[model samples]
Structures are given as C-alpha cells and as structure tokens.
Target: MNLFTDFESRIKDILETLESVREKRSELDFGRVNVEPPRDPSHGDVATNAAMVLAKPLGMNPRALAELIVEKLKQDPEVTDVSVAGPGFINVRLSVSYWQKLLSGMARAGVDYGRSAVGGGRKVNVEYVSANPTGPMHVGHCRGAVVGDALANLLAFSGYEVTKEYYINDAGSQIDVLARSAFLRYRQALGEEIGEIPPGLYPGDYLVPVGEALADEFGTSLRLMPEDKWMPLVKDRTIDAMMAMIREDLAALNVNHDVFFSERTLHANGAAAIRTAINDLTFKGHVYKGTLPPPKGQLPEDWEDREQTLFRSTEVGDDIDRPLIKSDGSYTYFAADVAYFKDKFDRGFDEMIYVLGADHGGYVKRLEALARAVSGGSSKLTVLLCQLVKLFRDGEPVKMSKRSGDFVTLRDVVDEVGRDPVRFMMIYRKNSEPLDFDFAKVTEQSKDNPVFYVQYAHARCRSVFRQAADAFPDLNLESVDLASAVLGQITDPTELQLVAKLAEYPRVIEAAALAQEPHRIAFYLYDLAAAFHAHWNKGKENPELRFVNDKNRELSTARLGLVHAVASVLKSGLSITGTSAPEEMR
Candidate 1:
C-alpha cells in the first residue's frame, strides 16, 4: 500500500549488504539518511543523499560509496534501476509493477487506505475555542475551532486516543457583566422602559430573546430580590443562554467538543479546587512569597511593590516567577488554568495541545512551565497560537467593536460564503500566520478560491463516470478491477502524470500527521486536484486520452479504477476537515 515504504526497505537491505562487506575500520553512519520523492520526476521515483552524509565519516569518496550502494541494490527486483546522480546522490526508479500493485491495494482499502499507526495509542487532549461565555462566537473564533478540530481528527486517524475539550470561562467578571446585561433585558421584557444600554453592558439584539424567555419563566419574582440573591440566578440564566448560542455557532462551523469543562464547576459549592492545586504545588517547593520586578518593557499602571503568593515558574523554564494569588487573596487566572491542566493530566493524557489566540502569546511559556511543574515533566504539552484573522468584505476589512455588541459571528460568514471555503481557507496556511478571508473572492467559482478548485476537480471526475456509463452500461463499480488489466494501457502522458499524485497519498498523510500540521492536507488536496484537472482538460485536445473510449471498453474500465481511487481519497480527506465533497460543480 505504501510504495515509499517499500523502496525504503529495499534501500535498507542494500545498506545491510554494504555493512557486511566492510572491514569494521570505521563506524558506519546511516542515521541521517532519508528516502523521498525527488522534486523533479526526471531524477527518479525516490532519491537519497546517504552516501554524501556518510562519505567524510567513513573516509570514502561519496561517489565511490554511492556506486557500492547501487551495485548492492541491483539485486532488488523491486528496484528496476539505481543510478549515482550528481556527486553522491542515489536516485532509484521503482518497477512500474510497484505502482500498479499500489493502486490495487488502494482500491481494496477504500477510505482506510491512508490511516496511520504513528500515534501508537498515545493519549492526547486538544483544547480549543475556549471563548468566554459572555457572547456568541464571532468569525475570529472560526479559525481556531477548525484548526483544533481538524488537528484532533488527524491525530485520531493516526491512532491516538484523542479528546476534544472546550474550557468555559464562566467564573470571571465578564460573566458578571453578562448577568447584569441580561437583567436589563429582563426589565425590558417586563415592559419597563430600560433606555439605551450602558457603555459597559452587552447590547446585542440576541439578548432580547433571552430577556423575554427569563420574564416568561420567572414572572417578575426576581424583581424584588436583592442584587446578591439575583446575581447568581441571573448569572446562571445568562450563562446557560449564552453557552447555547455559542454551541449553535460552533455547530454551524461543523465543530463539536468531547468535553465542555466549566470553570465554575471546578469550584462547585465552594469546594476549594484552586486551593488544592496550589497546595499540591506547595509540596513540590514551587510555592513562595516574592515580589516580581515590574514586568520588564511595559509595566502595568497599577504595578505596586506588594509581596504576593508566587510560583517559582522560572525554575521550570518561565521568564520569571508568576503570582498565583492576587493581593486581595483571590486566585488569579493563572491559578485556575493550572488546576484545569492538572485535571487533564489526572485524566491520563500523555500529550496536550492548547489552541489560543495570538493575543495570548505571552501565556504560552508560562502555562507550559505550569503544566511541566505539575506533571513533574512527565506530560508533554504544546501550545498552538492562532494568529488573528482579518475578515474582508468587498476587499475591505471588517472591524469588530464590543460597543455595538454586534460582531461578525462564525454563522454569519458560513451563511454568506459557505462552510467549505471557510474551512479550506482557515487551514490553507500555518495557524501561526494571519489569514485574509475575503468574502467576495472565496465565493467566486474560479481557480482563485482553493476550496472551489479542489471540489470542482472531484466533481469533474464524477462527470467522467456519468459519461462513461452512457457509453458502456455494464461498468462494475462493485469490482473496480484495475489490477487485472495491463496498466501499460494507460500510456497517455496525462494519465501517467495523474497517477504520480495518487502515489503520494500514504506518505503525504504520514508527514502531515507527524508535523501536527493539518494545513498540509489542504495543500496536498489542492495539488492532487490540480493534477486531475490537467488530465481532464488534456482529454479535450486528444480524444483518445479521454477516460471513456467508445471503441475500447477495456481502456475505459481500467481508467475507471483510478478515478474511483481519486474520488475516495478526496472524500476521506475532506471529511477529516469537516468539508463535504460534492458530486457536482454547478
């Protein structure tokens, strides 16, 4: 199934023969060797520079070493030819039967063709879209949601036991403000003339429905209660309503979390979980009383010389020790976060990934230090910083303002441009880089939009199938038999070139999974799509090259197998990223 692996194993056998003939005068170093597809097909199927890396160490000329390796590899029937190219590089041309056999394996494997066991059953917890429960999810949240969800899917496909988690910030002052805003709407729902919303309160029109619902349920009974009694009631109601809205926004983007850990639930009934986390740190000698020098560069305006309870984070690789408790004896945000991560470790996750906004750039190192310090360096944690997304409409940037309480929700963009374009563009680049989401350009059914281009290619293949069915009524999809046919019949240059891309699927999935970069899948799909489109368009110029030939049923059925494999892989990859592979373009 994996042609690259087959070539690598054959090359390793050659290395073994080279080792047997050596006199043991020097250490044989093949550690840095790598076998991969050459950038230019003219070079060969797989190329390696092992001889160059080993020449100086083994005290042999690189070209001589390469010649020895090639002589040894001539014994492998799988390697049709091995050449010493350039100074010491080895280029290997695998037998054409290797590729044809691979296509057969792919057809039999179906969607599971590229699944990997790279994770080896390691447990990983991925936390994403931990947006505050004060408002609905906006477009800024879309990128992180998709990246994190896709990352989880990628890891799971690679055999990791993965957990998709969302951290709810329900215990902060922001939630308090949300409650106050909801109380204002409750009064308005009661027909009270609560004028324009104050500057500090949420003013979104969505809150109006929440207010009406509250009035309908409580019947104005909370009006006479004191602020303290009503605060908790209002806070609970508002958070319940807001979290519901946030969930709907995420669903529109095709995201769902396995766990929704609420911050308030951590301290339910004043159970003192944050204190327990600090006390556990105390046993490890990380707790201390210290006055941090005013944060270098820009000090907070209220920075004072007050001694506070601090954690010796610098010992674990932080810039400096950080305050665990504020001057008023309340746990800071860092303390609660520490407790949450501890819970993750306790739940048996061997590795963890946190997806956060670029504004949280400073939080990465310190949070990592906390996780390491708590887990005694036994747990591995990685923080993926998602840079800001600048949304564009008609080539103009959309600005978000908290004052109007009307932001561009994820639902808004998905409803306007659509889900596939949004998912494709979000992961089309590194997550650390800022993205430009232009609504006008993404919806265009042109090559300019990558989503449409890939989907169009898949749809194009289906068109070929429909046309082939017309010319031949008995084409059996149940037995997509390409193995029995002489693959040499696919002699068109365009057909052979497209097969080269299909050959890369297994290796491509492995690399993308290993780097924890789902965006590479987006890039690979586009490349495959481009190759397919080129082959499709070339048929117009040469009628014999068309997938369906009225005169030759044998040639058409053989090409059908490759088309089926292409469409299947495209569908699986798109599904992993929560994108649909439509069967038609128009």
Candidate 2:
C-alpha cells in the first residue's frame, strides 16, 4: 500500500469537510503538491508544500493556509505533531506506531510494497537505442539503453502499461553503404581483392559474414546481376544481421524491447506509415509547402532558393519550423520519427517517451509538438536526453570512435565489471549529465563505489541473520509467524531511525517515479545504506546493544524485523534499476 497516498486521501476528505462548512466550491490544485522527507532530520519526518502551492490559487495567505492544514493534521491521532516552517512549508511528525505499521505492510506485501496506481495502467510507448542497424552497438548507446529500460521498468511498476520499442533506420543512404559494403565482402569471400575499403564504405570486419552468406546462397549467380538487382537482397540480409547483433548486445545487459519497427518499411510494399502521417498532418493544417530562409551566419556556395514541405512546429513550440522532406525528395530523419510517434498514438498509447542522445537535444521540443499535433494534444510525450559517457581506465581516458569501428562495445564493459556495477554506475549520474565511468574504481571493493556499498549493507544484514540462526535455533528468517514475536521489542535510537527510513520507502518510490529521476533512487539507497551501517557499527561499539542478546528473545526478534525491512528495500530498489543485490559479496 502507498502510505503517502492514503494520507493524501484522508487530507482531501478533511479539506472537503472544511469547504462544505465554509460554503465554497473552489478546487485546490492539490495535484501539484509534494510530500517528501526534509533535508534536515531535525525539522521533522516529512515536509509538504501544500500551503505554498495552493495559497495563491486559493486566494489565501500562505502562512494562514499552512496553519489551517497544521491544525487539521494535528487532530489525526496518527500525526503526533504538525508545525509550519520556513514560509509555510508544513512539517509532520507521525507516531512511531505509524512506522511499525509500515514494516508490517512491507512484510505483508514484500516486493510489491512501493508500487502505486498513479498511472492507472495507461499505455506508454518508449522508443530508445534506435541506433543505425548497421553494426554492433557501441558504448555511446549503452547509457540510453540503460536509462530507457530502467525508465520503462519504473513506469510499469508505477502502474503504466509500458511498451519498449526500437526504430531501425533501414531505408537510408547509410543502408546503401551497408549494401555496397556487403557486396565487397561477398567478392572477398570469393577470393577477390577489394583492398583497403573505400573511404565512403563501411570498413568493419563484421560485413565478412554477410558476404560469405551471399556466396553460399547465390553460388556466383548474383555476381552476374546488375547492382540494382542485388541491392535489395544484400540490404535486407545486411539489416537482418546487424539487428541480430544489436539484440545480442542488448541481451548482454538484460535489456529487451517489446517491438522493433523498421524505417524502410514505413513507405514500402504498398503500406507507407510515413505518407499517412504527412497526409493526416496536412489535413489538420499543421503541414504546408513553403520556401525556407538561408542560414543567418553563413550561406553555402551551393545554396539555392527553393520551396520545401515543412511542419509548422515553430507555432506550437519549436524554435524553427522543420523540413520533413529534403531537396532531393527523400524523407528526412525527422519525418521517420514523426511517423514512429504517430504509430504509437495509433496503437492506443496516450503516453510516449523518447530516450535520445544529448546531441539530439534540439529535437525534443519539435518531437513533442508533433506528437501533440498528431494526437490532438492528447498524447503526452517526454524526451529524455542521455549525455555522453567518458571512459577511463586507471584514471586515463580510453578513446572511442564508432565510425572507425574500433570503439568499446556494451559487452566489453559488462564483461569487465559484471551487470550490477555497470547498471548502477550508468544510473548513478543524471541521464543529462556526462558520466565518468572509471574502470579501476568500479570493481574495487571500497565505499567509494556506491554499488558495492549498498550491496555490502544488504550482505551484512544477511550475515546478521546467519549469526542469529546460531544464537536462536528456532528462529526462521523467512517466518511470517515471527511477526507476533517481534512486535514492539525494538528500542535503540539507531534501530528506530532505520525503521523510519524504511517507512519512507513508498514515498521515495512515488517521488522518484514522478520526477523521472532514477538518480534519486541511487542517492536514496546510499542514505539507507548509511543508516544500516550506522546501526551495525553501533552493535560493535556496544556488545549489549548487539542484535543477538542471549538473554532477550523479544529484542532479537525485533532487531531482526528491522534487518529484514532494510534488506527488503535494498532488494526492491536494486531490482528497479536492474541491479543485483547479492546475499554474499564475495
């Protein structure tokens, strides 16, 4: 259950009662309110901006509204005290019994404790890692893959019906390069010399297999055919091989998409989604043929004034209206993307998310505007920008260049550091910020690595359980029957603090999900780990304060209950971000 949501429902009831008594019909835009723990623990258990958010809209003084809400909260027995602090921010102090109930709820629901129905099972399409399906996915694609997959996981847990998708750029000049490159490999497989790949062609050794397969299939027949005749067969087979390679790379990081849409298929075989998108936009007055202006700073020598088909995205929110068709009468990359989003809206998904490289930042506003136009402002599309990744080994930079095709692949990183560390480190920084992935430090068993520290917290908790088995032979770590045996036996300040942190789990999940900031989860896990470590260290300082006191079975059970809750949150969070929580850290 979502404790914060339950509290919000109750607050709404009280507010409705007040409105009735006062004879008012005004709505309080409470949807924009936020509830979270204060940065300073001394302030209180939770802070809310209800008063500040509603004061101006409701035509009331901020301090006055805060005081009214404080009085309303104070009447509830669950909330022991409520105070207004710092210009109408409300701080709430709940009874320890409220925290105890949280642990009971966690134990009852297990891994499902933090899930909320905020999304109401609405469909959301997430398109990401739509890298050119021409070669192996390099390190540049890894960050977007992690962010998109983790976001899909988070949105699903928050009650969304999420569909992960990849858009293959198969119909483009790049694929023509792939076709010609494969033809060269096909000749090479036939013992011909195609020395030092031409500068305009793909040079990766991966095309060798495609060439060999072609020789096996045609047995010298294709060699006699015209270039155009062989282009289709070579292109399709090359795309198939490239996509298979990309899927395997994604599989290495445990990322899987629900669907794969091809760009070339958009206007091929008498079924063109792109043409349909343009027609729909044209019918809606969002598209037109217009002359474009020359560049303000520098006009190219080959520049000629011409008319072009454009989308009026600037009126909606784009900085400049965008061209959908190039001068050569071919669809621009933006046109394919518009069709992709329109397809998502057509598939009954009202929500769409695009995880794009940071270099594509300029496209965010236009893409969202297009989605708005196509779906008549009903589709809410969000674009997450994944910044560059800087790779370092022993504090030295590891250079990467994909065009040269000698860069590090996703598999290389995962194979070197394993999945948990790679996933955690990739998400430790906000997706819009560049990440410094130091190879030397990630694998080191030190507190500097946040992944290992969080895992160590979980592993230490398990060690305590193992030791408990030695002290209390009858105690079952997994026993729900022990609930009665553990109630109200916990007393240490450190233990109580840890329980309160666990009580904040549902709130943390709700906030993090709404913020679309998975880095917050990483930070929260670190704080939770700190709390668990603080209490564990206290046990070493005071042997009588230890989890296993031979004289008191009640205290042992209570402390174990707290330990179980800590482990539960760590496991839940790690699972959310596709990280693993090991029972032992060896």
Candidate 3:
C-alpha cells in the first residue's frame, strides 16, 4: 500500500529489465538502490538513485544510465513526467489519478494504513527505566521510560515481537540503605523518638507508609530479631513498596512493562545463573584472573594492585578488560549484567535494546562486548543513551523537589503538566540530545505547542465530519465505505499537497521503526499536522475550498474522505507514541 515502496519496486523491475537486455550488466548489484521523496518538493513527488547506484557496476556513466531509466519510467501510466537531475538521480512526477487512487486505498485501510511488517516478527527485548527499587521513579528516569515505551510500541506496530522490560536493581547496596531508612521510619511509627534522619539513609516521607505497614505486620516481632534477620525482611518489604510506587508512577504516565526482570535473580540461591554464564564464558576463553595497572587518570591514594577475576572484554572490542568479581569475593555489577544478558539470550531474543541514561555512555562498549562474548557474536545489542531533560517555567529553571530531597520525581512532572505533554515532550528530541521541557510552552493552547497542535488537527478533522453531517444530514457520513468517494474530484492544489504529506506516513513509520528512533514519528506528525492546518486555513481565504460544500455534495464527500484519512493516520501515529488523539478539545 506504500506508494514509495511501490515505486521502488517498479524501479527495481525496470533495472531487472535493463539488466536482461544486456546480460553483461547482470553482475551489477541493485541492492543499494533507493527510492525516496526528493529534497525539494518542487522537483518531484518521488526520486530514485538507481542509475547512480548501478553506474559503476554496470560500467556505464550515471547520466547515460539515468537517461535510459528515465525513458523506460516515462512509459509508466502512473508516471506523468520523469527527468534526470544532478548526476543520475531520477525524479518522478506521478499523475493526480495515482495520488487519488492512493488516497482511496488509504481510506479503505483506515487506522491500519501505516502498519508495516519490516521486522519480520523477530523477538526484540527493550529494557528501560531500570531505576533502582530504592525509591519512587524520579524525573531522571522519565525520558528513558517514554522513549523505551514508544520504541516498543513502534516496534510492535512494525511487526516486531517486542518485550518491554524493566531491570530491577534490587540486589545492590542501595536496597540495604533503603531497608535501613525504612527501619528508622518503622521505629518512629512505633512511637520511638527517631530524631534527625541519618546521613546515609533515604529521608523521603514516601517510605513512611512502608514503615507503618511493617510496624502493623510484625510489630515487636521484627524489632526483637537480630540485624541480619530483620534486615532481609525489611529490604524485601521496602523493595516491594518502592516498586509498587514506581509502577503507580508509571501508570500515571500511561506506561506499562511486559516483564520486570530482577537482577537479584541472577545471583540468588548461591549465584546459579551467574556461575553458569561465567562457566560458558570461561569455556570460550573470555574469563581470566589478572592483576593490572592503576587507573590512567589521577590514581587514588589507596589504590593497590590485586588479582581479580576479569573478563577479556578487550578481545571483543571493549576499551579495557572488565572485572567480574571484586576483592570482597562478591560479583561485580558487570557480572550481574552479563547474567542478565545471558538470561535474555536464553529466552531467544534476537535483539536486545537498552535505553539508558546518557551518564551511562561510558558503559556501552563493555556491554556490547559482553553481548558479543555471551551470544557468540550473534546477539545484536543496541544502547540508546538518553540525554538529560531540564525543566523550565516561564524561561527559568525549575527547582528540585523538597519531598524527594535533591531530585524531581517523575510523578511531579506528570502531575503538573499531565501525561500527554510529559510523554510527547520526552521524545520530542533525539535520545542522545538534551531536551528543555517548558511547562509554560507545553500548557499553552496556541499552535506553538506540538502536542496541542497535533491533537487540535485531529480534533479539527472530527469537527469537519460533524460539520459535514449537519450540512448534509442524509449523507450517512459514519459509513466506512469510502468507495463512493469520487477521489478524482479532489484536485485543489492545497488539498493535493496535504494528501501528498499523508502519503509519506507509511515511509516515515518504516524508516523510524528501522532506525529505532521514535522521535522521527513525533517530527512527522508535527509536519502532517502543520500541513493539515495550513489546508484548513486555506478555506478561510476562499469559502469555495471549505470541506462542507452544500452546493457540491460530490466534492464535499471527497474532501471528507481526505479528512477521514488524515484523522486515521494521526490516531495511528499517536497511539504508537502512547499519546491519545482527541476527537474533541476542551
């Protein structure tokens, strides 16, 4: 159904035809040939680099090949004009009937028009928002959460078997700190005067509920137990409470994970999986015991050379060998990461995508090295490092949350600006690029706000349907049967331009999904919305361009069909980004 793909296929067929006419050129590879929209819309609707790609291989000059291809392409009934530009790029102008027919096909497809099967149903594991289960999710976790969720949605829409996962950092010392913090709150709950929260403990009042629940559950029983006995129980309870709070916060943002994988599971019960994975690495000669030089930069005063279990990460492209076990005979964080990746590999995931904070940029090489070592060079692991987001109010820096100490909680952002703004703004920029989210701008009703602008376009389309129904009450506008829509009547220049933008949607979805970049969807929707709004504004200058033409029901129905297609594409794109496309805006 994608016209661009259809054109590309046609171009390939022409190339095949040319190759058959000259069997000597059959050895040339057409794999790199590409068909896309020309840079300048004035040039053409669709463009191809078939001649440029085949020139050197066919032992023919680009312009000569392009002329031959253009001659063959002009014969196409759908291609109204064809020309060679620059070196060998072929620019094609399709007829209005072709665009009209494409619109008709789109109207029939409805919201499923842009769905693609490029992924071929391969399993992809997307892990993000793996914030430690020590407290509620904060603003730091917001970008990755939205990005990861949208990516999973996009992948699923593109035919990938996606697993949205959260890795719980519950096996770390942070969990112990959380336990001690909760214990203090529990003592206070029991009427003990626990004054001035300790320096190393979490002082957030969110833990008070966990403390009160613990006090009610065991009362004096836990208080009588030794530190070792009580600490485990306290840690488990605190992690559960914190994870519950995190999940609730995610729900507020309208995000959900298919699986919440625990890092502790790798090392629990005497490190079974960790040992097994390490043994597998050992069998592959990736593990070794080594003593090394001190860190390159300013060495620590207490730095000492010691033997430790190390992975030969450098052999697989890591900057340096990474430690697996520390001097205290405990597994390093990297060891747990390896086990986690191994678990995912065992689960039959063909691709593993980690949406991590930009601060973890240094960790990428080693993680990729681990993936290569663990999967025997078959695992495709991609890490998307999301840069920081700075919140602004009226152009001033927003202050931190007093409730959560130094950082702003994710719920705080969602509560203030609402979910749609939060989700949209999060991915409005590239993951590796920093974003500035302005509350004042996001909340504004004007078209300057992207989410509002896009939603308003959808609302306007719905508004058109309402206007059409009232203008022609007996038209039966609710029917999905757009076959009666006389698309040939949709010949207005501005209207054709809007439809042209709509035609780029499937290409946008396929490209964004293939690149694993969801921000492209956001940008495309903005452009589509802008084009739609421009067309809507055109009607104001000329009343004859109005969507509801009581004097001309044939053209009116055709225009409404176009509006319906726009709305459907908007809703489909919004759904993939986890944002709602409102039919009405209050």
Against the reference, the lDDT scores of all candidates come to: 0.83, 0.81, 0.90
Any idea what lDDT model 2 has? 0.81
> In candidate 1, residue 564 scores what lDDT?
75
**TM-score of candidate 3 relative to the true fold:** 0.97
Give per-model CA RMSD.
2.2, 2.9, 1.7
Candidate 3 or 1, higher lDDT: 3
Best by TM-score: 3
> CA lDDT of 233 in candidate 1?
90
lDDT of 2 by residue, 354-411 (tens): 8889988867888878987898889898999999998999999977644436787777
How much lDDT does candidate 1 score? Answer: 0.83
Deviation (Å) of 141 in candidate 3: 0.4
- Candidate 2: list runs displaced more than 4 Å: 1-3, 6-28, 32-34, 49-75, 86-88, 297-304, 326-329, 400-404, 482-486
What is the model-wide C-alpha lDDT for candidate 3? 0.90
**TM-scores for every predicted model:** 0.95, 0.92, 0.97
lDDT of 3 by residue, 468-541 (tens): 88888898876645644846787887888888899999999999999999999999999999999988888998
Q: What ranges in model 3 sit over 4 Å off? A: 19-22, 298-304, 483-486
Residue pair clashes in candidate 3 = none
